[model samples]
Structures are given as C-alpha cells and as structure tokens.
Target: MSAPKIKCPTCTRVIEYSDQYPHRPFCSERCKLIDLGEWASEKHKIEGNSIYDDLLSDDLEQPD
Candidate 1:
C-alpha cells in the first residue's frame, strides 16, 4: 500500500504521512514554527464565542 499524503499546514507543501515525516502535518520544523508564531501573534483563532469572555465579563461587573 502507498503511504498516505497530506499538505503541510504552514507552507501547503504536499508531504507523505509517515514516520519519515517527523513533523507529520507540518512538513518540517520551520513550517511548524511558522504556524506556532502565527498562533502566538494571534493571527490564528477558532471561530466562536469564547467561554472565558462570559467569565471575565461577569467578574468585571462585580465589585472586588
């Protein structure tokens, strides 16, 4: 059977999904790091209302 393939999340490069590709979905360490940087800078986020927003807003409305 042929190895499964996937596109790297950062560079969109096609790569084999196997032990040979240690980074798996990332293609390489550089691509993985770039993705990490994006997350750290808040460039990537899930589309949804965050549960923390309600908790924090409730705290702010109450007197400490």
Candidate 2:
C-alpha cells in the first residue's frame, strides 16, 4: 500500500503523509514556521475557554 496523502495546512499543498516528510502536516520548515507565527500572533486560536482561565483570573484578582 502507498503512504496516505494530505494537504499542508499553511499552503494547502498536497504532500505525502510519511516519514520522508519531517513536517508531516506542512510541506516544509517555512510553511511550518508560518503556521507557528500565525499562532504566536493570535491569528489562529482554538475556540472555547482554556482550563487555566479561572485559575489565572483568580490569581490576578488577588492583592499583590
């Protein structure tokens, strides 16, 4: 059987989902970094509240 094929999340380029591609979901390091940059810049986010939200808020509300 042949390795499965997938699209790179950043550029939508078709690639093989195999060990040959170190960046499995991405076509290359550049694409991987681009995705990471988007996340770091808050351009991409997972919907819904984070588990640490309440804990962080409580800590912030406390007197320093």
Candidate 3:
C-alpha cells in the first residue's frame, strides 16, 4: 500500500503521510515553526468559553 497524501497546514503543499516526515502535518521545519509562531502570538485560539474567565471573575469578586 502507498502512503496517504495530505496537504501541509502551513504551505498547503501536498505531502505523503509517512514516518519519514518528522513534521507530519507540515512540509518542513520552517513551516512547522511558522505555525508555532502563530500560536505563540495568539494567532490561533480554541473556540468557546474558557474556565480562566470564571476563575478571574471569582477572584475579582473576593477581597484582595
């Protein structure tokens, strides 16, 4: 059987999904780093409410 094909998340390049690809979803280290940079800079975020908001509200409601 042949390796499954997938597009690189960063560059949109078609790549074979196999053990040879250290960066599975990305084509290269550069592309992987770019994605990481985006996340570090808050360019990526999970949708929906976070528990941190409730925690902060509770903290604010209490005396400091």
Q: Each prediction's TM-score against the native?
A: 0.78, 0.77, 0.80
- lDDT comparison, 1 vs 3, better candidate: 3
Model 3 residue pairs with clashes:
none
lDDT by residue for model 1 (14-54), tens: 99899999987889999999999999999999898788887
Lowest summed lDDT across 10 adjacent residues in model 1 is found at: 55-64
- Name the 10 consecutive residues with the lowest summed lDDT in model 2: 55-64
Tens digits of lDDT, candidate 2, 1-64 = 8999999999999999999899878999999999999999999999987888967776666765
Q: Which stretches of model 1 miss by more than 4 angstroms?
A: 56-64
Q: How much is the lDDT of residue 58 in candidate 1?
A: 53
Which clashing pairs does model 1 show? none
Flag regions of model 3 displaced more than 4 Å.
57-64
Ranking by TM-score: 3, 1, 2
Writing each residue's lDDT as its tens digit, candidate 3 over 1-64 gives: 9999999999999999998888988989999999999999999999977888877775566755
Better of 2 and 3 by TM-score: 3
